[model samples]
Target: MADVNCHKVLMKALDYDERGDKEQAIHYYTMAVELILSIEDKEKREKMNKFARQALDRAEELKGIKKNESPKESGKKSIQTQSASSPTTNAPNKTVPTVPTHSPKLEVTSKEGYTMEEKKVLEKTSTINAKVYVPFMEIDAKERFNFPIPFSDKDGILELSPKQKKEFVQWMRISELCQQPEIIIGTNPDYHAIKQTVVSDCSFVSSLTVAALHEKKFNRRILTSIIYPRNSKDEPVYNQSGKYLIKLYVNGIARKIVIDDYLPVGRHNQLLCSYSNNKNEFWVSVLEKAYMKLMNGYDFPGSNSNIDAYALTGWIPERISIKKNDPDFNGNQVFDRLKEGFHQGRCLITVATGELSDAECDRTGLVSTHAFAVINMAEVDGVKLLMLKNPWSHLRWKGNYSEQDSRWTPELQRILNYDPKMAQSIDNGIFWIDYYSLLNFFDVFYLNWDPELFKYTYCTHKMWQSGIGPVKDAYTIGDNPQFSLAVPQGRGSVYVLLTRHITSIEDFRENKEYITLLVYQHKNGKRIYYPHDPAPYIDGIRINSPHYLCKIRLDPNAARKYTLVVSQYEKTTTIFYTLRAYCREPFELKSLDTYLTTNLQVTGEWNSSNSTAGGCQNHKTYRNNPLYKVTLANDGNLAVELRAPKVFQVGLELTVKELDDSSLTAPFISKTTDNFRSGFCVLDLENLSAGKYLIRPSTFLPNQEAPFFLKLKSSAKLQIEKEQ
Candidate 1:
């Protein structure tokens, strides 16, 4: 009976696999394969071995990894291959949105990237976060928005001096022509309302797309975020209001965008910015313009869509990574977490393929290295589906669940809330794919979390002085821009996110600095380090480390202070940052802002003049080491540490010689054994009285010469310097 059940399940899985619901099929197939292989009798195992192995391979397909053959699959398994790699491009010289006009539409034939069932290719489809409302911050409109535009006519909308023409063409009011034209903050904002234009602000559009997906979750509040205070019938009203205001968070700071009703009109009264597909709709256009002005004109050099999502919806944008080769990849767990985030109104998930150029996207049948919003997830007839939308509203996935997929039955369609009339069109850019297909094709996931989930509070515009942190904080690489927090041992939970402000310098669009956030506890006068915990729960690392975060959990009686330090891999460039802490109750957060330790800190750098200078263990050039002298006026706890990049092999040695011992090789009072030989070396000493000690920095390998930095901190006033 057990054997018969396994066979029946495997058959059901195989049938679903043939039809396209890979997620559910994979689940059932995995169960059957596991059971079939578990048989004790060789005869029984042998009989099912062929199909079991095939199911094993197909099971991987569910996770979006390699796909070879399916159990009893016939002919060529019609799965469209992704596009070939393309050369990635940054903005023109790094700070401009350099997008050429979009090319004319081509006749998208089934043969293009639709390498799968002809019917599936025929189906074209479609498809951060932030804490927002705190005490409302009011900005002086006159001081902040100095640029003013007059409402106008014939020559378009607002008057712009020719000098500013490149940034903006002209602006017209919503009521310029229509006697009572008003911006509609729709009762329900749909994904169809958003379509990416010729700009490379996909990050911006993708984030917005995701937010639109959840507009209803927050009572459809995000859609009409920007409003004219003096409106009617509870809807946005327009009485030639002259100017409108939109509140957006930029790098943690909330700035109000005041705009004249004038619309930016291009060559023939064509609205230039992002406009809703509905010609009469002006919300998206106005919102985009406000965003453009907020970002210092439409000169977007490209940005993390999560960041845009934050500005738009005040939600925290977190990134999720799923490495196909990672041994620990669990599809079910990932889906479950995403589902929870969605239902709890905690996240808006987005996905992207590997970076590809326009040409590459065309050749491979993939959208141009773009981002997609996950609008829906459903399970029908045990078949799981993921509905995604392309921001461009064209060029969709050519794999399973495509517009022409023959699986769109009225029953399945109804389960997915499918619109039959809308489904008939291949250009809608909205489409569905099984979880397996999504995992297999897409590699990156952006989760823009709702701030409500954490009761988030933030401190924006925190400057991290380069010399003030890492290199200068202490010889310890982890002693940079830090803060201390306390959770009442068993408090609910806490999450902290640190975001580096995107630099506006023409040369530094992406993160010019590589930084990490580490949290440690200073207990019983000893430091405990957690290299990688809490990350699994927090926002974690995003596309890059520009925005990194972690969560914290405390133990009973362990309600001690946890110190969070932000340091860099390279450890040099300075950056301005924002720290947002989320917790059930108010977080006991305090900055490590220049305390007494700041006065006791000292840093010195030394380069190997010769291999003999910093003696090596094998070479025993002990006398040939660079020496540092420390003089403590009073008893002080002393810490000495050394650091060098990956390129160098170095070490630090300890030998307490009397301060007055002038001899180069004066017999050492106490010498280090094996503890100090490392790239990042530290020698922490306890209960030292006011006295002098000598420290040496050495290379662990013979004949090694590399520049290294050393940090010395003491409780008592002290002087430190390279020994002569």
Candidate 2:
């Protein structure tokens, strides 16, 4: 009989098949076949042949079927039977509402410059509770399912908690908010509609500004995508669902934020932060409420607009720093890149100015250390002009293109698409700037690319266990998950995007997830261990944002398997992550969690303190370092390697001691050499005694945590200490 693990994998394959995912089903089926084939015992193999044969047969049949054809309709025999609770049964046909028969032409597009892939990813992550919230759907609005949020006892039989009672009693109906609270989220999400109130979250609002800027050119910002009962005017119809769901990409996966209508109200029911200027337009207000709920409260320490852009659009942000005085500075090239990016519908660009004094900000008509959205660009008769939008409604630029200036003539206004009437209004946040003035004022720009740039992408969602007792950090090396990516031959770009999920509103906390992505190539034509090399294009160490992105360029010579290590500096809470690889061609991502070996071999990727942080080497940090404990029931040999970034040399030191209770100590062993490739410490012992041993691998470089491998070969069993 197959074991539980094997059985579960096969069942997952069956489920994927039922969901119209032939490719994923095939992957799971192949995993099942490999699992059984790995059994060494002859008796076990014979008994498991039933399962192994079934997996192979199903895989073959599925492969033979055309992708466009359904396997169930092909009438082929299935190796694994469907489970009992497959959710397909004869019911009233009312509960499981059928999706209305709408053609693809009915699909709505957004002005966020979303490519096809970005749009699809966004749609998948959004949750539509049409029966309750979107009553305009074919489902009946009065038919309430679950009451969405569990705040109070509906029966009135039990005592309500104080918090719940307050929320229940103070909950204002959507109908009572205004004389005519438009069901529509907004006429259109324009800059004027959003206003930052008490909370400090301009980065998020600036992201909305960018999303709102392109609606006239594209479709709608993701803001309106999840709103229910959108009327013919592109406004949402208000109903009694009393709840709303907004979609955001958490760590790479789409997570829905469920929120009730119990918004924080002051003397006059004023929204706390990020509200619309139009009194009755509640989308911005509702969105802020849902976000606060997701954040757990009113704690918005503020973050970069790029970070919020990723959550909103599912695009990976690229950071480009400006050094104006550098000899390599090319203003024309930068301008051309931005121009082409916007024209090709490939990027949403936003800029941040250097810190400004309060007086300077007010006098110069700019916000201090504020973010601005790039809406349009033009070069009319050799004069470069950039259209921008300040999230703040009144801070108009006082530069050459200022509203008070004479530069806004007939031809220039037409080129910049400026409406002189609207430009004079304080509520309209739009403005245009001279090309030279833009480069002088802005310090940094954030660019998020369209998903269509990558021909293929492979994404996997996982959870990393970090920050527990004692050290309160993640395992230094070894234990964290590693993925082996085989980048096939090509001259293309690849990006590894790591994203973390945002928690519920009341459960929100500052993200303490610091991650680094490292890649290493194979050596000497060996297949077992692919060591780390200081490769270029890796992201910086310890990025605290919800998302981290690193880029790698592949060429004809870069066709090989590279090991990708996802590591953390310190662990706070259990972090959920999604690892996404975007490339021009299809690639393979294989997990190396179970690829354990006892042979005295080499492992680990190469890294250096110069380019990246060297791990807990003595020279890097004098005290409080990482130590790995390995226990041997019998005699064994341990190899500690120190490899260089450029050269293939290795340096190492090995120390063996018994557990504190054992009261035993071995010789102080160390090795060094001036010869090339001489930095290696190998312990080759014969008739080695069997006992618990603590092996501390060190290097000459102080406080440097260089990558190394520990391979042990012994007759007796060996066990590394349990990793948290």
Candidate 3:
């Protein structure tokens, strides 16, 4: 009977596999494999194990293909071939049927090429169709004068400059702006042709420049992939209907931005916003317009290129300060890293200059507070060099490797594949700078790395409510949002990114909130009680930027589990955020949900008269600490937490007691906090027998008067009440 059931299950799985139902096929195949392995007769099991193994291998191959493909290319077909045979039971002295050596190929077509995992990503994304906002036919019929027009009640026109708003002649479509308007003028995006005009978004323009250069160098579409209205080849094309949808990674998820084709024109028939040098290429304008719309206009305040690049490509953003203030800033190490990362197509690099005086700028031929794209890096004959592009499309660096510099020897030119003379003829803002010169001239390096470099990625969206925890998390992190990362025994890189959602324009300009991430080595996935007790594996610096990244490396000898705490300097408002983790090795990431099935919270204060101000064990008044009675109905785990004001040091102590025992002097099993922490402490008891218990929450010092909150969590149903 068991053998017959296994054969029936295997046949059902094959039926699903032939019909391209991978989900059901995998399920039934796994079931059949498990059943066949349970047979007691070794000879009979071996006869059927081959078929079960084949089915299991095919299922695993399908899963592996889904894991290896990029999210965009996940829609491609996954094909496999399998023999059409079922396991058979042989009677004594009877011959078994021969399995076929070859069978027809089976093609499994995923819906829209998206697996269950990719569909989850799409479910979180917000799609906005332009036609729903402003019908394209309405604009063509003149029913609407302008698309995304400036109005007092809307986000439109807020980013426009005073000059742009005053000199704005009209909203002109792409066809009217140029004689032969094309979304992308050339076969590939040209980084040199991109020019910044009138707008103060040098960082954004520089971001686009390097992104375009990456595509040209590697033949990958980093910028164009976001824009919609594409041809069958997936290349972005101009939309005649005046409606387009562009996907941008913003706040936390991939959000589709819908915009019209109308471009802002000045009185002199010149485009008011950023434009491309090629008169007909409108991709630069279109992408910029969509991004500007997200920023709430053309009046874009300055931002680093890494942030812009993250929004454009969903890559990991990392900022490295080059200022002399940082004692650890090593120019040589940074250069080597950039060279390796850029050449390997794992990163996009951009450098920004600090505020420079006019004389300083003139001497170096560099712009003040401007962003420049690092398009290429080379090491020729031990001479380190970098190719940079100025978004202004003009000023070339007057440093050692400048066009007019004497460092350009024929030998150097040949090694670098150069034509300095031709480069000098056309002032296209491209120049070579020595690594040392770059270290001296640039103030910061913004690197956006390819997340695909890691085999696993995970993200979680959350909200941090104001007033839930202490405003300043300098001493304790028990109340902060925390996560657990379980890495298997291996050596690999792990990165955790905390992205604060941008709810308003003030998020960029005001710079009110400061946030960072802290990682620590933890055992048994326990919560971190104190900030510096365990010594953080990676202590991040707090910054107002939307993204904060914390990186750590795992070794086989190190602990397998870690705790990640999202810390804020002083939280003033309720903030929405997304935490994403990328790892080179397989890892498990999840929020540390501390709440149990049955929970209770109570508020109390340590004061002189109430007898609740009893201090630590050393003090005679410890017996007078605030006590609670806990009654458990079954064997389970119990967790007790004590939270006080920053002024007081607190801890929790739990003691198992008899059913009728009311005395505080004696207890069965006692567990106390390892140490008193400022404002927070925790005590966990696992596998306690069903019975009554007593919990004591106390301060560290005698006569410390402050309010505190005690919380109790248990797996089994329990009742907790303050002891009278």
Which candidate number would show the highest TM-score if scored against the true structure? 3
Each model's total of backbone clashes: 36, 38, 4
* Candidate 1 to truth, TM: 0.63
* Candidate 1: C-alpha RMSD after superposition: 23.7
Q: Candidates' TM-scores?
A: 0.63, 0.58, 0.75
* lDDT preference between candidates 1 and 2, better one: 1
Span of ten consecutive residues with least summed lDDT in model 1: 95-104
The TM-score obtained by model 3 is 0.75
Q: What is the lDDT of residue 671 in candidate 2?
A: 30
lDDT of candidates 1 onward, in order: 0.56, 0.54, 0.73
Ranking by TM-score: 3, 1, 2
lDDT of 1 by residue, 1-724 (tens): 6566775576456434534566877888789888887888889787666556555655664656544444346333433222112212311121100000111112211113212322221121100111122212433322222225543222223333243365554566676635545566456555577876655567777777777667655565654644444334444444354556666665544555556666666655666566677666666666776665545455556666666777776666676665766777877778888877787667878888776677756643566456788887776776667888887887766666766677778877777777645765657677788777777667778777666655435342366655443232223333556677766656555667777655342323455566666666643214322232212122223235456657677565656677777656544555666676776554467665433251333333333444344445445566677777777776656666665422234555666655443444434466553333223556666566656788777654444443345667665677776677
lDDT of 2 by residue, 448-527 (tens): 77666676777665656642111111112334567777777887677888765444322223555576676655421112
Error of 2 at 250 (Å): 2.1
